[model samples]
Target: MRMMHNFFRIGGVAADLPHGWIDKCLDFCDYFFTGVVEYQKLITRNPIFLEWVEGIGIVSGKEVLSFLFCDFIL
Candidate 1:
């Protein structure tokens, strides 16, 4: 917590707070589009990740929706 306190400043909805408020601060961390390295690691490790996915060939976006169950799990 000490390391993160200096890295970011809390304001507005987050004003004077307590140690327990650390969980609330974490709400800002919900992020998408992680980076190239992380992206590659994501798709490559996903068993259902269709490597041949290109030009919308093998499956349309709708067809793939049925298989959606889990995310990348290590």
Candidate 2:
């Protein structure tokens, strides 16, 4: 299985963390931010992705209210 079950209890975990678990977890925490930065650099800062989203689907407050108040059968 991809994950473990019966590892959580109502109040706490089923048992103490395994040896080296904390170190591994700390390493993952360190790596996670780097992964997020890499993702942002590759995706969010990409020129092609920005070009696709630029000036698209822009809505004004008036337009939003018009849609929100428009009457229709539910």
Candidate 3:
């Protein structure tokens, strides 16, 4: 990840991977996270929301509103 970040920083453009790489990466992520979600379900023995937010730490609704609308005023 650091290497990819540095590559983009120096190149000043998005790095294009070979064809099918994006799809493969997405597939792998889906598989791995699916396993994690299943394990969480088994361990917790409870139903979970299919869509949920996590790790959105220390966010203020007012701050978000201000930031979102700040450009409109300018």
Candidate 4:
């Protein structure tokens, strides 16, 4: 109940939202977008990020198959 809030049901929500909550959510949405833009400017535009991530996840088909079929129990 603590995690699920007990206000959610199979069909829909079991309770109406509190007053002013919608405005708060809308404000957060705007703030979150600005934060995303700021983060992209700081991280995605950095040359080090490209150098760090380039050629990082290269995987062969044999490695993929071995990983998929490996037995982990020992």
lDDT of 1 by residue, 31-74 (tens): 43336668888687766575555345567565566557343331
Off by over 4 Å in 3: 1-15, 36-57, 71-74
Estimate, for each residue in 28-66, the C-alpha lDDT of model 3 and write its tens digit.
998998799788876566444432334445678777777
lDDT of 2 at 25: 96
Cα deviation of 56 in candidate 3 (Å)?
9.4
Over 4 Å off, model 4: 46-74
TM-score of each: 0.21, 0.40, 0.36, 0.44
Residue 48 CA error for candidate 4 (Å)? Answer: 7.3
Error of 2 at 27 (Å): 1.5
Model 1 residue 23 CA deviation (Å) reads 34
lDDT (Cα, 0-100) at 43 in candidate 3: 57
Where is model 1 more than 4 Å wrong at Cα? 1-34, 51-74
Q: Candidate 4 residues 23-63, lDDT tens each? A: 99999999899789778887888899878997999998877
Q: How accurate is candidate 1 locally (lDDT)?
A: 0.58
Q: Which candidate gets the maximum TM-score versus the true structure?
A: 4
Candidate 2 or 3, higher lDDT? 2
Q: How accurate is candidate 2 locally (lDDT)?
A: 0.83
